[model samples]
Target: MAKKNSATKLFVLDTNVLMHDPSSIFRFEEHDIYLPMVTLEELDNNKKGVSEVARNARQTSRNLEEIIGTNEESLEKGRSLGIKGNTHVTGKLFLQTTALPHDLPMLAGSKADNQILGIVSYLKNIHPDRQVILVSKDINIRIKARALGIAAEDYFNDKVLEDTEMLYTGITELPEDFWEKHSKDMESWQENGRMFYRLTGPMCPNFSVNEFIFYEFDKPFHAIVRKISGKTATLEIIKDFINGKHNIWGINARNREQNFALNLLMDPDIDFVTLLGQAGTGKTLLTLAAGLAQTLDKKIYNEIIMTRVTVPVGEDIGFLPGTEEEKMTPWMGALEDNLDVLNKTDEEAGEWGRAATQDLIRSR
Candidate 1:
């Protein structure tokens, strides 16, 4: 054990933390990091596969090698993590060169986890004046560490927001008196058959471009911010995809959220769009409908390629026997189901016509 300053805390990183985010080592600015030998062993064991975890493990090994360099003496004394370009990382990285003994009880499973816990316990004993915390992604490991009175915390650098409620939903609801507050100097016009409004008020500065805003009061208003400059924002009336006449490839938006999503998806100016919702929220269905409309009807896109990560929920089904498309067929059951629904939207198209349309959609 080595003596440390009271201001600098020592963070003992678990194998899962490194596997989750390789750059986590550099993220703890001005705080020292200690890596147990068991953690290194686990990283080595996980570095063989082509999965993201394996790739991150390999990258962590590379980062360690870069930090450790060719100085064997520094390995025992701890290496300064303040590399030339990364001035923010002003702490040293300590690797377990020699094992520290602990009197903790033996755990039944996961020897690596137990060994890491033991190392944290030993470090806490030696560095009583300094804070020694265990950073792990596994909840069970955190619980075990806490049960033993060892300070434990989840690696939070990878989290985009501490509270998910603070996340941007890409939509905002206007107050009931929105018109009365902002309609004083509001300017209105039309461009390309789309209605546009320029408004300046206390709320104008808070509005972000492309963020949907709606009012469901006496007169429903749904629009998207097109431009924002100074204290003024230009809002364009979004297409009413919920109306049957404005359906996208035989699919109409079922609700206000879906209408906003379709407005973004169907827009030609927006190059990228992301949809986040629960399983039955029509994300896939709406996306497929918009893609089909653009690719097949509008002829703006040459093809629609649909693919998703083929992660099985349960036991592995073993190697699937087929070409690339055939292997992916099982994973695309949702896509197939959505296409069936889209194909049936045309009542005028007979069964044979629907089947032919489905074939065309699949081919593209």
Candidate 2:
């Protein structure tokens, strides 16, 4: 860590730090906020990117320009200068010089990043008494800065928290006369919304089904009940793909996340679904089987829309690739193999489940 810059630290805000959290300069509160000139130049250059992140950066820059213009003078006094939420700006807290080479590449060999580094190096060398901190949201930039002997750190306030965790017990066993030993407690168990069980680590359950009871492990890992039979089932996960069922495998659906992906696929309001999943998980097999059941047999969707990433793992499709589709064909060839896995051999002879998936997509 660089020496702390009194209450008014001189912070060189990297382009990425601003993009990650537009309000960062204001966050330091009445500090010497330094915006690298190159950072602004690069943001202006990225105004045309169609990504959400790019749009946000452009918007934030425009907003900042308005603030800097409004408080052009007071910012130099090192006092509160801008909007209420924003800390007072201090005039151009940093000076400019073409100290860095302009010949560096824009991205692959970014001149902006190198220039920001140069500015920090300049400040550190000339103003040894002042705390010169380079704030960047890019992990790689921070690493590169450290490698070049610049004091760099990540802007952590904008980061999101990860979800909490819960432990899983794969197996639970009850003695042969299970109810007899616990009968006295069974009546009050369901009544008081409590289910308690004794844990013995001697046994473990393998490839399981309903027998592996699910419970809320927060209290005791044994207090809750798996209600598939009579109690309330907290949550049920359909593990195996039904023989001819649609969407049984590769559940890349987003419901389990934010009720996002799968719901989008199933909603009549949505007309398109693009799923990406890994191998041996029935990504293709599940859909094809469903299509057969819903479509040709009983009209559902007009047709199925499918696509492949095209590039195989490790090898680049662009370099080794023959024709675009030809290169991608082998990847989808797995879909053909999955179709064979479905009982599609006698398609016209009987009720095929292929229509189920096709019709399902259309209905959604």
Candidate 3:
């Protein structure tokens, strides 16, 4: 209820938070962690069996034990988590032993969620000078805490990116007047069938190797920032993958981003390729098409090994039957679907040829 300050605050962690990240308690650099007794009970109850949840529960128990040690007295007062091994945690850990008085709504019931909420309210009421926040991974718990006027939030320490839209696209669009401003002292030369321009300007600092740069004012220009020497940058025109002789496996890029992606994807010199996009954005299709072109057509690589992280939806249908490939067939549905599109690229290649190509791909 109090306005947050620079002083170290108290964070009441839920069982799911600990299970999500066993090292979460230490992630709060200067804040204190308060663990309710019910959270420990939940962790203990879950610390059986061999599932990921069970493993996480066991790890959480171990982490708690290592933090608490053999001193119950220290925990009662407050145990400093800044041990020698983990000097990052400049905070203390507290354990709730005595029951806290609460005025939770009767409809809330006496579940673990309500208990954690009760403890948060109690901590807020007692520690009026400090901020008390509840951290959990459960959406419903967060909603309930907010309804009860308790400050609650999701555990974001494990987030890869706070916003996917903010991810860099490896491309920068130059201003329309870029040439008018920075192309005065530019020098040009042609070598090995590629045109390179040496431009010295204020934009050189913004240039990085392999970053795509394009300008579309008056005369359109599409180039890549190949190198930078002090205040000068070398810009090489990108080989048009659309209509030029650079099409990949009958697939031509339609847009600037797609062109950039195709240039990177089909480059045998570039070993690693990472593509990020939303569904229906042609990420898988483009990657597979490039892969087929390189592996089956050009013989750039011996084989293409397709793999994905096996995240299950709902309850898993345990123990799929078949060979390793057959068992993984369900997960490779996206690859198969994309292959269907790629196979149609060669219309003259009859049904037999398509089937043969599919067989060759699977065999590889």
Compared with the true structure, what per-residue lDDT tens digits does model 2 show for residues 29-136? 555666666887877776777886688687767666655565455443432335644435442244343343333233245567777777777777766777678898
Residue-by-residue lDDT tens digits, candidate 3, 1-364 = 2233538888999999888888888889878889998899999999899888889899888887888888746356677788747898888888876777654765366788888888899888877888789999999989988887889989999889958679877888899878877888789999999899999888888888888898888888998888998989998898888784666766778777788888788777778878776788778887888988988788888988877988777888688988997898888888889898888877789899999988988877
lDDT of 2: 0.52
Q: What is the lDDT of residue 129 in candidate 2?
A: 79
Instruction: Indicate the residue-level lDDT of 44 in model 3.
Output: 92
Show where candidate 1 strays beyond 4 Å.
Answer: 1-8, 37-58, 68-90, 96-115, 137-143, 156-164, 313-316, 322-325
Q: Which residue segments of model 2 deviate by more than 4 Å? A: 1-33, 44-60, 66-69, 76-115, 122-144, 153-278, 287-304, 307-331, 344-364
Candidate 1 deviation (Cα RMSD): 3.7
Candidate 3: residue pairs that collide: none
Instruction: Give the TM-scores of the predictions, in the order they appear.
Output: 0.82, 0.44, 0.80
Model 2 collision count: 26
> Root-mean-square deviation of each candidate, in angstroms?
3.7, 10.9, 4.1
Computed on alpha carbons, the lDDT of every model, listed in order, comes to 0.88, 0.52, 0.83
Predicted structure with the largest lDDT when compared to the true one:
1
